[model samples]
Target: MLINDLIILQRGADLTKIAEFKLNSFNSFFINFIALLIFSLGFALILSITGIEPWLAYIETTIYNGQILGLFATLLGVVILHELLHGLAYIIFGAKLKFGIKYLNIYTMDISGTFYTTFEMVVILLFPIFVLTGLLLISGILFPGLIYWMIIAILYNISGSFGDIFMLIIILFMGKNCKIKDEEYGFSIYT
Candidate 1:
């Protein structure tokens, strides 16, 4: 659906383009941060509850032992590069430029103004995976110790890529006429 359509949504359009973009940015960042925290906390809780052997779970244990400064730097680097890929993909497809954000939920290109076919959509969706994978593989092979950072980068990209993955699936199966409508987290794809 288009941005104007979104304004006519059932609850009534409550946001201007700038407001919506700002809200989206805040939501994206907050959600990703909360998800990561919850994921880590739940994993830790499970391990503690199960009485896992600490030394045997050395990888898990060591992750938490990582240097805070290094972690933040790695995360910031991954996020910036990831968004840059998105922006570049938009340009390659000739889509109008839109805002980019560091946080997961808030980041989006406001290219509803332009139309793209399924193939172009696929290109946009898959660009980051292709770019980041090349970067990850090269870095991991050259400096094996950087595997952790690679993992962080890949997962970070994938977290946001879920929407693209869904888009690709629908466009492939349902054709260009397919539209994804929300019903909570999972979407309903129909003509």
Candidate 2:
């Protein structure tokens, strides 16, 4: 099948394969979760100990009573925009989107079964970094009270984007042989 016609086998067509896929993905998700948690907590602690509050944090806690709500809203907006960029980029580059595949054990998920080019994935991966930065800048100026939440949201995006960046690095290193594996034995084979 062409990359454009790809589909993720949610159940893997058999119990053994299904169990294997789940186990592999579960392990990956667990490691990612722990890494993200530790990194984020450590970074936040450093900020606290150094008395280096981001400008947004000061404004958020000081002025508005609804600051918490604003932060939550901004965070939700950031995540939605990030995923949308990926899906849209896939579509624009001639790929179709299957259901998003969230690893039940992790805070992140895959945009499952997307039919896009390597170049398409790269662009999609970078899109949110730029887009989110622009949004943060504009929102910071327009709504200072949401700054703390915005910082958290940006950090979250960057942490997740780390893997995408690494994926791109491997693709570049491996040349055209780069493909996201769906399984060890039954990957969505790419040419």
What local distance difference test score does each model get? 0.56, 0.54
Give the winner by lDDT. 1
Off by over 4 Å in 2: 1-24, 34-42, 45-70, 105-116, 176-189
Per-residue lDDT of 4-61 in model 1, one digit per residue for the tens?
5554363233222211112345545565665576546655665676566742454564
RMSD to true structure for each model, in Å: 9.2, 6.9
Cα-based TM-score, every candidate:
0.56, 0.60
> What's the residue-level lDDT of 137 in candidate 2?
70
Error of 2 at 19 (Å): 20
lDDT tens per residue, model 2, 72-122:
676577667777766666566555444343443222224344333456657
